[model samples]
Target: MIDPILPFSSYSEEINSMLPETIQKELVFLIDSDFMDWKKIESILKKFPSISHSIVRRRLDVDFGRLSRRLTGKSIGVALSGGGAKGFAHLGLLKCFEENEIPVDMISGTSAGAIMGGLFAMGLDSSDILPLIRNFWLDRNLLGDFTFPFVSLVRGKRYSQAIHEFFKDRSIETLPIPFYAIACNLTKAERKVFDRGLLWKAVRSSTSIPGIFPPFAERGELFVDGGLLDNLPGSILKERGAGILISVDLGGGGQIDKDEMYHNLLGPHYLGEAPSFFNLLFHHLKRKL
Candidate 1:
């Protein structure tokens, strides 16, 4: 059975008339920006200049079943990997899924991935989430607490607060879709999968980097970034009952060996004055981290 979407014509005129000219222009500019390409940009550009509510309605009221893939009774899961800011790419992937009318049955993620997955599971699609992040959340002053060079650079108080505010007391078990967030137990040196409890706390714990953000503490246990243990949480998606898995690994290549790291640093001109002092320093730091 197919779920029907509200017809584009139903509210198109009312919505268009309600928007101010300046706000509409800003939205146009944002869509035209070079950072993103949705594969239908050319079509949008060609039609938008002289667009009409009736034309948009006609264009949208198509036989969607013919254009989209048939809904097979298979569980499709997406597993997102952690790589700090690179996790934002998950938004683009989600947008693609939305465009193609592919339904996401389950999602599992670590670190930054957890944030995106959690938001989606809460019922916000890519279109709703991108604007929220750009216009509000990303603009906040998150560096409210700094710490001496010890276990972490910052106490993460402001960041945690920001997450809590964004979630608005939502719990994991209450989400529309099944979601899993991966974190790590620092004391036990093991992975922790969170499928329930406060959404913000799980996201905070998932993204708590060891030397960057202080480990999150709950009930006598210390939790740090899930990337330390499971950067790509595809296996969890499988274990939970997904037949088809789509894993997005933004971490690029796996860990580099010490020799490769040095070789890449030196480049072709190996007039090596016995590897730079900073190279040895970074190597040691990498091992410690």
Candidate 2:
């Protein structure tokens, strides 16, 4: 069981004694950050302390091992970019990482990238996600639904339900791995990072497109796709002390399709003084086309 609001001091004595000072400090920091799972923290402590305690007897140098890597801040962070359907490539990327034995220590994502990243963070492998995509995400009836088109083309109820079904209302902080989902607050006119909340809601909020899907209302603020603000969210990982950063920008400049042009001006929110750089570029290319 995970402690939602407990600080490091409230943990059991066994766990507290098993952890190193660095890890104890990190646990406090993570609790303050509001985005960590105690199980993952405990696992790290359990795995590393044994090695640290027996390194001398095992003829392994403490200066050049897992403990050294942890102390030196050599954690690997991968930032997944929003690209709609193109974001599915993130699963392949993760599979490749697993194949090459590259473990991801942290993750940040926007829009569709959040969906893939969230699943990975929840301990689902790429192979597991493939069937999910085929059975749920690729369902034409769910995604291709049309409504009266008030705020968006689709009502977004089904999409939201789909996300909830996939994640099963799991809390973001309870995941086995660290993850962040980026969203754009329409009411605040700023970017939002979801470190703690229902995992499905964060994924849904991040994937909400202004014209395609209705915005998610939370705390009196409307939130849409993070792609509208910070599409590639590697900066968050860097802020958290990740030494190596791998950012995948799948939503970069490309040929504007007919579907993309049709949904460009469905609302005033899509056209403002400070529009997204990619959105602005998409509009410019639409006129030329």
Candidate 3:
């Protein structure tokens, strides 16, 4: 029986292998956007500006037989947390899940977590996505340092554009698994689960870190990274009736204090002047931070 959650009729080779084929590249079914010549939801909305929400829902509804079968009596949910570069570590954790044959019936994530989680839900295995991450992140042309001073320097255009390109051909409904990308509406001071709209847009919004990246705009509304409010959305998954909720938190501070620190550089209300040389050195380090 064919799993119908995804349009497998449209699947092509997602991973290719030459030797040690079984362990290296397995046949993974995924929907091909180019094969379908899919148009972005944004483009479709523009073409039919007056289209009703119900119509949009109808158009976005995908056949979910496969996913339904997997979730027959289970309510498994996986929630990925926000942790900039630490997401790679989270990816490793996901790889562990795969090795253990754990089923992620539904998924939600924020920031880098959202990006990786989205890819996994779209039928890309960790092996398939590892190369994409390496190529994109290691490309000097894409991540090179910027020129000009007096600004944040990382204006985030390159990364933001990359995000758009990745999802230019897909929508949320096409995900191979149940998916949700979490973002925040600054104006509303709340977390938003983007279960609709363009997949790339949701990913973009989920990664729009406050100072590091610009906000995402949709129909003139502004959205920033969901990490700003709810990074590990276990509550959201629980609210959705998740039977087994697995949350991967990157520990907001990303550090566990060892109870071994006993020094305050500039003591609690210090008014003393340090040596000129030491002050200059500390100031230099401060600027770097």
Candidate 4:
């Protein structure tokens, strides 16, 4: 499974408990992000000595050849990607896996993690799109590059506006940013404030980007919608009948407004904050399998 191991989320124990003993014997690589304390992960690995580890980070500079060798004889490769630079890096790894003929079952936590697990992976800049869409005009080596006229028209608009226009009839709304800050501050007093809906109002008022906006706002929304329903990219993982499981952190206000896209990245604060969603996904997998 392509499990983006966030700094806070740990699924190793759950995975170990769920898999049958016989199937566990064949599991090969337990690839995770270096952000995870190696000591903690190593301790967990000790329980299942048969599973090997591959820690990925920016400094390591992993390539497809290295990955191919790692998975040559393996039945399953549990890959992880999370955090800032790590999100883009994780997409690079996923691209590598697609190239190497490895079947992937992906799990993502926050926005960065979730988007990479999506069908049309989102990127930080145009440069990130090159690897996925090699034949697009953007990828063709252009002489005297001229900025697209559309870029100038949408410069000052909010992310939700850009996405709404792209989707035509689809409606989208931006998530309130104040809600995120309140969620981050985990205190009984803070919780009470949010419960009163003050946090949502604050986020709606305070968060504003002058010239910047989210890339692939519509694509991200589509993924969150379709990925949850297992509609888009239905052909990619056809053998499973259903696609991958998605669990969004409710602490991040998992309040997806229809036809609206939040400007900032969405995610959970710390781990275990969205246990209900996790439990729901677990039960769904149990029934599907």
Candidate 5:
């Protein structure tokens, strides 16, 4: 009944005529950005055109809004941080929330935090995801940008594909709760939000740890990890109107050892000689390696 890859061109004429001016403009953006193909948009439009159409259903639906208000009536936001495998610590944190009967209204994440946040937004229990991560081997999952780099052992699209398998036919907007990834544009030294397009693409961008995983492109913009700009994204959740914020720390602080920074004495791809300022700073930052 629903297909994510359905092409929009199939019913283009029918939809273009019916959609309002504002929605048409939005759809144009989605189509142009490769976020939603024409067909998938058509499928959604055909089923759920507007809130006006769902009014009858809304009337018949149980007014859980009243029940929700009766029970504390507050929104809680969860913020997750990036730390590669260190992010697994969030499972224990999320479990604590579950045991405490705290509810999550929205989620914001960066880097590996994006993976955990995305799955949770898709309605997967933290317990359900634990086994998946435990069985996952980082080296076997993704192959990086080029074959020559040891990073080539990181297979990005494969990870994206596996995520699609678990979160089939769901994009960012379709998730049960509002979820977003913070990604940094290395070229601009700016922080950006991944709210549109493929959830995996955004997750990939958020998790793209510069030299570790290659940059991801979305709508013609390149994005690396959000940690580059806002490593701790507590402020991001606050901006999103979180009534209360719960932060799960999966990060560490330690002294950087310069000797371990060099890989085979090649200076981590000879980045010291690179022209970009980011590359230069990257070399220094990798001192902690």
Candidate 6:
């Protein structure tokens, strides 16, 4: 019941400190940046055989590569490589776990790593704050003069209202800019899929579907909320099978209330380019178990 975040190297030590000694030997998984050597990871795993360990390295590079490729058509094929390159690493780890029949005790991290961990828990894609903001700006052009400044200010604010205010101020400053990606409701099918827990798994698998325009709608209930789908192309929404699209604010923010439609923002602190948040998040997940 310790709520430690994951991905930092010291996570193991922290978990050891927090948990009862008898339960300290449980298996753990640490997914983080590709800085640590596999040997080191092996050594750590060996130290706690009862606690198997794994890492998904090069996480950000993978996401950035995917995003960059999407933004710039030149790298489309590479970018579309599902969850970016890091996703492949994650899959490889998952494959290993599957082959070995290893059960993940916990997963954690900030930003992408945190997102994946959250997805593992909630069975959905954790909202990417930067992408959400970028998409918002792309659709509205409201943050023309305030993009960077607004991001800086909002990074520290974790409360839902504070984030709403930030968006409101940006809207007021920009004028006539509509919020394009806010979900007002979940379709009946979407609600049913979400209730069944198939929505998130579909999204994760859909990433691997081949095609220049992979049908997101056909992929089942996307883990996005109604607003996100609204912003997406019409064709994409129509093809959905059972994927649930949770509200942007709810998913991005770490608020864990399953009943609430909204959640806090993930904040810039977690999204900053610095590697610390990633490391910290991963560390927290690996050791906490």
Number of clashes recorded per candidate: 0, 0, 0, 9, 10, 38
Candidate 2 residue spans exceeding 4 A from truth: 1-24, 28-71, 253-289
What's the TM-score of every candidate structure?
A: 0.64, 0.70, 0.64, 0.24, 0.63, 0.19
Off by over 4 Å in 6: 1-88, 123-289
TM-score of 5: 0.63
lDDT of 1 by residue, 135-225 (tens): 5446876664787846667778888888888877676754546689999776666789998678899999998866667889999998977
Candidate 3 or 4, higher lDDT? Answer: 3
lDDT, residue 104, candidate 1: 78
Tell me model 6's lDDT, rounded to 2 decimals.
0.27
lDDT against true structure, model 2? 0.69
For residues 156-244, could you state the per-residue lDDT of candidate 6 as single tens digits? Answer: 22222222432331211011100111121211222111111122222322221111111223233322222211211122212321122
For candidate 3, what's the RMSD?
13.1
Q: Is candidate 5 or candidate 6 better by TM-score?
A: 5
Pairs clashing within candidate 4: 4-81, 171-259, 172-259, 172-260, 173-259, 173-260, 173-261, 175-262, 178-203
Residue 66 lDDT in model 1? 16
Q: Per-residue CA lDDT of candidate 5, range 155-260, in tens?
A: 4566666656654556676554568788877555577887545677778788776555657766677787776655556677677556677776564321111212
Least accurate 10 contiguous residues by lDDT in model 1: 52-61
lDDT of 2 by residue, 1-289 (tens): 2233455345546455766767633332223334444455444444434322101112323212423444578867899988777888898999999799777767898987899999988767788999997887666467576898766788998888888898886877556466899997767677799977689999999998776788899889988888766788999989866788999877453212222421343223543546543455345433543
Q: Give each model's whole-structure lDDT.
A: 0.66, 0.69, 0.61, 0.29, 0.58, 0.27
**Candidate No. with top lDDT:** 2
Best by TM-score: 2
Residue pairs with clashing backbones, model 2: none
Selected candidate, larger lDDT, 2 vs 3: 2
